[model samples]
Target: MKLFVDCKKAGHLCDKGQYEDASFFEKLSVRMHVMMCKQCAKYSERNAKLTKLLKDSKCKQMPEECKKRIREELARELAKKPE
Candidate 1:
């Protein structure tokens, strides 16, 4: 595996790390990339902050049934409207 990753891959790895989903090598590569890239370092910092805030918030997801109902209602309403 490469010792370094690009900014895009680093960002992806950062997200995975946020959820504790990234493997050790992936995390290492991303960290190495961040160390070399100033922009990625900043991005990683913000991502970590966001992840911490989300975890602390104890937020819940809206049910899929409710989302489907909302979508169906919106579609019906849009269909009734004249363009």
Candidate 2:
């Protein structure tokens, strides 16, 4: 099952804080996997940085009007795209 838990999915789990609920065996498994997976370790670091950036700016609010306009533009762009 170790092969099933590749760095990508493990990184996703780590991002979602699944480590808190992981069993001792699972934790050891992930630890061992990450030790050899530089790509996953880098992914974890990027996730951490992004999470910190988002949390630190949690109070900064986007203007509703600006958001609406951006959404509308995105919708138009999406509509123009071919399936």
Candidate 3:
């Protein structure tokens, strides 16, 4: 199987817990490839730094009522059964 050009990109997507998350084995394979490739290692370092900066920045907070309503809507949605 082919490996991803940037293992950090795979890790970033994996962190999001999204439906499109890459498989652990696929990421492990990419990590292995990166270990042997200097260019990929630098790319991974840059991506990691960017991710840290983005996560560290402050953002606006939602109001308490809005947060509660959003939670209730999510709970109701989660309770629904799939066809």
TM of each candidate vs. truth: 0.72, 0.49, 0.47
Q: Report the Cα lDDT for residue 54, model 3.
A: 73
lDDT of 1: 0.92
Estimate, for each residue in 1-83, the C-alpha lDDT of model 3 and write its tens digit: 55554555544543432333557666676577668777666765676677678778897789999999999999999999987
Quick one: ranking by lDDT, best first? 1, 2, 3
Q: Candidate 1 vs candidate 3: which has greater lDDT?
A: 1
Give the distance in Å from residue 20's predicted Cα in candidate 1 to where it truly belongs.
2.4
Q: Per-residue alpha-carbon lDDT of model 2 for 1-83, expressed as tens digits?
A: 46447776677567555435555555666666678889877776776687778777857678999999999999999889587
Please identify model 1 stretches exceeding 4 Å from their true place.
81-83
lDDT string, candidate 1, 1-83, tens digits: 77788888889999999999999999999989988999999999999999889888967999999999999999999889586
Error of 2 at 28 (Å): 5.0
Ranking of all predicted structures according to TM-score, beginning with the best and ending with the worst = 1, 2, 3
Where model 3 places Cα greater than 4 Å from the true spot, the runs are: 1-20, 59-83
Candidate 1, position 77, lDDT: 95
